[model samples]
Target: MEKLVEQVWDYTKHAKFYSYRPNYAPKTIDMLITLVGGKNLKVADIGAGTGNLSIMLLERNCNVVSVEPNDAMREIGIERTKGQSIEWVRATGIDSTLENSYFDWVTFGSSFNVMDRNEALNEAHRLLKKGGYFSCMWNHRDLNDPMQKIAEDTIIEFVPKYTRGTRREDQRPIIEARKDLFDNIVYIEEDFYFHQSIENYINAWRSVKNPYWDLETKEGNELFEKISQKIIERLPKEFDIKYTTRCWSAKKYK
Candidate 1:
């Protein structure tokens, strides 16, 4: 599974995936800012894919260390954030090589599930000063929406082995399990909707390399064909998809 994820993302260019990916609601960004108390605080955005979260942080006047291991994604991130003074570092969550007890905040945006959670949390705790914050968030597809349920269910039936194609985990239980590492651990969630053309939506899934690669075989293509046809036939020309961005934060105590 891990290798499959690496395989998929390694080829992920900064085009449609970055362009069509869901945005973390502005209010959620504001909440993270509030949790950390303000802007211009030092931040390490681990797994900062294409610098989406870093861009948000920079807009709030935060100094960002955009750590991403994938060169393709990192390059696109750098390209996308051109003229903005973001410090882009090529590193993973467990091996950031950043200084300890220095950054005011550490964050993971839609990328925490990729890491060895315990190691990453420890690294996050180590890199933050006493009372500094560490936060992780994801823009999750809300399964409860009617249109979305059809969409999700269709994919599941078509791709029986389908998981989110990457690790789909809730960090709350892990956070609580390692309570000794931090203080005031808390979780926050909010729902927002975004609309995209059905084509763009289908293209987004096509960008998911693992399943798409597997489905590239004769047998798999048939399933994807069905999914595409269903989307075209059932969904509106442009329709809203509900997403929940769940962010969890804690302050390092020791």
Candidate 2:
């Protein structure tokens, strides 16, 4: 776990590119908030990278505590979310150091995969008041789309055995396994389209944590350049990428 935490520091170099990544679906976010009893609730957003999800929660009128461990990412998050009803904290999902039984909800937006799952769930349970919800979500590219299929082929051409890791996996089992702490699990997935300039779309790849290639290395840079060139040649100046925000949530139990 310590090593995993250390490895996340690598995001320092890629922090700036995070802004190019697609955001979770707003409609799905509203659904999650409604399921947990509507807005104006207190939320702890773990691994709140660059304040993406935190900003969404804030816009929905939730008071948020944005907890992120990486300095570079956290700094960007702080800057992007300045003047909002948010408190930025330096912390990890396994041991957030947040108040016990204080928050109405604890969420991990595109971040639950980076931590020890069971430990993170325990921490979330500890931070939530009775009946509060624990939720985690990721915005996944819809590979079935034509453009996305092209991108997927390009990635496979570079790294044949590429896998998206736990972020793309069904999270119900993990949360359900901890029945002693949580129950009434629900899963929601909503598809949405994101429009971006071709340049930013290519740059968004830089923020991905690909274990197959280290973006800092020469080989990694070469792979990135090749993929970017392919996209530049194949894609239009501005286009939409299909995305699906998949979310899992459960009520905390005693």
Candidate 3:
């Protein structure tokens, strides 16, 4: 196993932590489906956390190959996609162990940042046919919303080192500099509205992440509670937030 995969898979293995995550809007998935433009196409969804994106592709009648490294997370994904016909493989993005020049589409749903980004791109390029599409997408909180701003501020205050807004932005230059790895690169972002309860929202934050996972620790527990209470006291019973789902895609040129 690679160092990055081993480190992330071991530290973040809890499935319940992801139960409250906000789902990508149907329109977002629809756009991806339209891009690929065919039924029963082979799609590899790496970092398929809890099978969110895989489930969508399966519904569209695509043959989805879900590859995830964490057992707990993959187990939950298996459970979520039950009764559906799909392939599950335990693998990381940079080295999925899948054969080359076969799949019609390769996707990373929110896990691209955790991967060796350039290597993953190389692998995705290898796995796809010449005309195959590669897409990476994840939802971002629209912090321009005052409620979201409050949430981010509280998160940063407790975790001081948190880079909620800057993590993806920090990686932009890498994507820009590596255009040689893929061709006709383009980015598309769409804003979608979502509604969730405060309790569910906080629990979604409790995922098995480093420093933030061990809520049993004095420091961890305090930080977790502080953010939770602030959200409850501040937000309404049924609050809405805007989520921007961003997708980056390119083609495997001949």
- Across residues 57-173, which tens digit of lDDT does each residue of candidate 2 receive? 999999999999899999999999999899998878887879999999999998888888999999999999999999999999999988889888888887799898888889999
Which candidate number would show the highest TM-score if scored against the true structure?
Answer: 2
The regions of model 2 sitting more than 4 angstroms off are 1-9
- What would the TM-score be for candidate 2 when compared with the true structure? 0.96
Q: How high is each candidate's TM-score?
A: 0.88, 0.96, 0.90
Candidate 3: how large is its RMSD? Answer: 2.3
Residue pairs with clashing backbones, model 1:
none
Give the per-residue lDDT of model 1 (tens digit) for 207-241.
45454434447766776788878867888888888
Candidate 3 structure quality by residue, lDDT tens digits, 1-254: 24548465453435667877777777877887887778788999998878988988898888989998877788889999988878788888988989999999999888787777889888998999987888888888888987788888877777778764323564446566666766767677888877888777777677635545366578777767877887778787778878888888887776
Q: Report lDDT (CA) for all predictions.
A: 0.80, 0.89, 0.78
Clashes of each: 0, 0, 0
Task: List ranges where model 1 is wrong by over 4 Å.
Answer: 1-16, 165-168, 209-223
Q: Lowest summed-lDDT stretch of 10 residues in model 3?
A: 164-173
Best of the two (1, 2) by TM-score = 2
